[model samples]
Target chain A: MSLLSVRDLTVKFSNRGQSVTALNGISFDIARGERVGVVGESGAGKSITGFAMMNLLSRPGYIDGGQVLFEGKDVLKMSAREQRSLRGNRMAMIFQDPMVTLNPVLTIGQQMVETLRAHRKLSHEEARQIATVKLKEVYIPSPEARLDQYPHELSGGMRQRIVIAMALLLDPQLIIADEPTTALDVTIQADIMELLLEMCRSNMVGLMLITHDLGVVSQVTERTLVMYAGRIIEAGKTRSIINDPQHPYTQGLINALPQQTPPGSRLKQIPGSMPSLNAMPSGCPFHPRCPLANDLCRTTMPKVVQYADVEVACHEVQRLQSDLTSEAAQ
Target chain B: MLQYTFRRTIAVLPTILCLIVICFFLMRLAPGGPFTSERPLPPAIMANVLERYGLDQPLYVQLFTYLKNIFFNFDFGPSFAQRDRDVNDIIAAGFPVTLTYGFWSAVFVLVLGIPLGVIAALRQNSFWDYVMTGFAIFSQIFPNFVLAPLMVLTFTLALGLLPGGGWNGGQWEYVVMPAVALGTSYLANVARITRSSLLEVLGSPYIRTARAKGLPERTIMIRHALKPTLLPVISYMSPVFVYMITGSVFIDVFFSTGGIGQSFIDAAYTRDYSVILGLAILYSVLTFVLNLAVDLAYAAIDPKVRSGLK
Candidate 1:
């Protein structure tokens, strides 16, 4: 059974009486110990999906309609007490921008110990022990001293590691990391990503890694869901999605990777930026940026369908799959 | 941290000295001598009084004498308007009443204001949020002077639940109305700061992390949100603390609480130099010390500030 199953998750943001859908019936699952990455541009609702799954969407954003089943329990239907117990205990989240993700006033030790104590029947000392162990797992030196320090005292990379340690403190079944390394230095990004991957693997914990970096997604996630606007456009095994992208958006994202361009040449990019959520394109959210978009694509929204080794939502899936095969032969 | 606090404290002496000199000279600069009675004293008696207090001396000499007496002798001399009373003793007598209401006012602000603010932030845009915001604005607009009278009318004349005026020597019953009157503005300021800052902090990424941890909403708020929210509110309270300790003229007159403000202002009207100078020094010193205490508190609450202090 999947550790976390999200079905038809719809999120809406209501501002001054007008409601706009941020996540339009997006759905996916994470098996026990599996790593799934949700990739998209800034406004693609990647983070919204993560927040909605935890039932933690801030106002203006809410779970308009969705079923987030965690360990066979419907998260959206759970009572506040039940939801609180499920959070931080069975499913923890590591946030982006570690610099601001830890409380400025709290010592690292206090932050870690409190989270542990919140969900368990442990004294301060015992929680501190667990926190220290988690800190050591994240390769933090002088783990005891680090706990006494504040977020500001640590470098961005170190703060991120602390945040990762806090997420792993409770030995949760799944960890939802929303762009955990996005605010980090490029050099430190790989290190943080590697640490997160190792910890999750060793703990047998499932991970939903949400990020815009396809390179990191390919390296870390076993399965990948490519999000655009508020819907998943392509999802499959990470290897197949990278080797054979079916959706035009996924192809554009992959082609736009720095490595995809020849040395010293301009990087390939999707021609248009993501449409505003308030004014999403009619047929497909990605249609404006898709080269293969046609009148049918403009008039009809493509639903996710099984196509060549991937689940894709695009009118040109068949054409793209055939083109990929011929290109491979050449 | 201790060394930083000590250094800051030592650095205040020159400023205090400068403050005292300017205030002393400024008071002298104002018209009317301490002995300026409506019906003038006989010339011999006036000369005798001026000579006795050394008011007949040069301005610079009188300034030096006043500074030396305050710093070295620890004397505020005697009140010229009330011949029998010493300025220091008179001030000491008035302090307890002011401090009592000030203490209660602080308690009121913290206990009620902070939670109102937290609720407003947690329930952003809800009915409670609107109510709190409106209440804060109302409290801010009606300064204690205005609020004090309305409170007297409500609690004393209208409802008759408590006394209309008078401290009754710091009795709890008398303390209630005054505390509310004095606290309303302060409470509003605190609530506003807490609401805005906490609202900002709630939207911060760390708060989302706290929520994601599955900690109860209450736990997240008290543990993760309150401290950062307090940083700005604490700063706002520093000067207000000095004001409360010194007392307000409106509070003093309306409540009939014989506090330092009433004494100082009365001294100003009569040109009672010793009483005026005594209260001025007390205020300046209190203001400086309270500000230092706030800085020290900043270090204790925020580790970032603690590190900076180091």
Candidate 2:
């Protein structure tokens, strides 16, 4: 069985009079030790998926239907007390905006020690020692000095490292990092991703890397799931999805990437923005922007089609050979 | 830090100078001079009295002399009409009483207000929050006069539990009813501010981060949220403290307490120019100091603020 299996997860938010669906029955699984990247445009329910899995959805937004099974135990079915017990111990998650993630008034040492003490039965000194090791593991130089400093005393990158260190101290089974390095610069981004990947590799921990940057995802994640307008448009091994994208949305996302090959060549651009969830398209959400959209594509939603190891949700992909022929002709 | 403090202190100089100039002229413009009365004194006696107080000179000269005595000699002239005690002495005698009432009442408001607010915020929409909200509104609506007498009547007249008036006995009970009467309005204001600010802080990501760390809700609240939550509260406190001082004037009359408030009321009623001007200066100085303290507090709460100060 997969280490974590998210089945038919649907999350909704009701504001004023309308119920807006943030996650529309999306399903995927991460096997033990798997580095899975969930790539999507902003507002594509990527972060909401992670939040739903952790049962951390804020009020006005809630999990309407979902089964987030971790190691064969369904997370959504668990009682609040049971969920609390599992949250910081067995499973952990990090968020974007590291500057705001760590409390300003607290010393890094106090926060980390408190974090460790909360989940485990340990003395202050014991928790401090473990937290120090965790800090060292995340490659923070002068871990001892850094611990004594408050979040405001540290730079943004340093604070992010400290936040990551706190998450790693418990040695959770699964680490869901939601745009962890988005607020960071490119250089710090690479360092943080490398540190996270290295830690996961060393400890054989399952990681769900949620981000919009496919380049970052490609560097660390082995498998990639592309979500658009609250649904998984495509899913496969990272290479297959990137190189052989069957869904038009996935294809557009890949083509949009600036290529290293043929320097000075013009870059590809996705024609339009993703649709709003409140006034979403009639059937296939991406049909409005899909280049090869037909009457049937605009009228009916496509189901996830299992082709070998990958899943593609596009009606045109049914006549695969003819589509390949047409592409070749083009 | 030194530069900021120095700048702030220098900034208040023009303000103080302007206040002095305006007040000097404004008081002179009022219907009665220091010597004015229903029965007119003989011109000779009036001139003698004016010469005695150094008011025989030109207005500007008199102002300059007054300024010199105020700034250099550190002398607050004698009461304009009372003629019994100097303005400085009255202030000296009254300030400690003001401090006693203001200090205890301030302590009461913060201690009562902040926790009540925090509880109300945490239990948001629950029974206790609702009750506290009702009490807070009631405190504001119910005048200190009504509340004071009502409290004195209920606690002292009816129950014989506490003292009804001014600090007579050196006991906590003597202070309680008066302090409560004086503090009720401020307690309400502080509680309201605390509730709103805490609500905002509770929604911030750092608090959520603490919760995600699985820290107990109480620990998350008291440790993680409370301090930053207090930043706004502390900034607000200075003005509230000033308001408490100003508000105390009314409470003093109602409760028959001999504090700075009562003296201010008396000074205002009698149009004791020197005493009024002295009180004005005292109020200005206290306000400036309180504002400076608030800025220092802001620096501590937000490191960015301190760094920006550099």
Candidate closest to the true structure, highest lDDT: 1
Candidate 1, position A126, lDDT: 96
Report the C-alpha lDDT of model 1 over A1-330, residue by residue, as the tens digit: 788889999999998899998999988989999999999899999988988888988787888887999977899999998999888889999888888888888889988988888899999999999999989989999999998888888899999999999988888999999999989899999999999999989999999999999889999999999998899989999999999988888888889999999999999988979888789888977777778779988888887778888999887885666687899999
For candidate 2, write residues B104-188 as lDDT tens digits: 7889999999999998998888998998899988987897877988998899999999877675532577667767788888788
For all candidates in order, the CA lDDT equals 0.87, 0.84
Question: What digit string (tens of lDDT, one per residue) describes model 2 on residues A86-121?
Answer: 777778888899988888887899989988888789
Per-candidate TM equals 0.92, 0.84
**Which candidate comes out best when scored by DockQ?**
1
Q: What would the C-alpha RMSD of candidate 1 be, to one decimal place? A: 3.1
Candidate 1 local lDDT, residue A131: 93
Number of the top candidate by TM-score?
1
Q: Residue A209 deviation, candidate 1, in Å?
A: 1.5
Clashing residue pairs, backbone N/CA/C < 3 A, model 2: none
Give me the displacement of residue A316 in model 1, in angstroms. 1.7
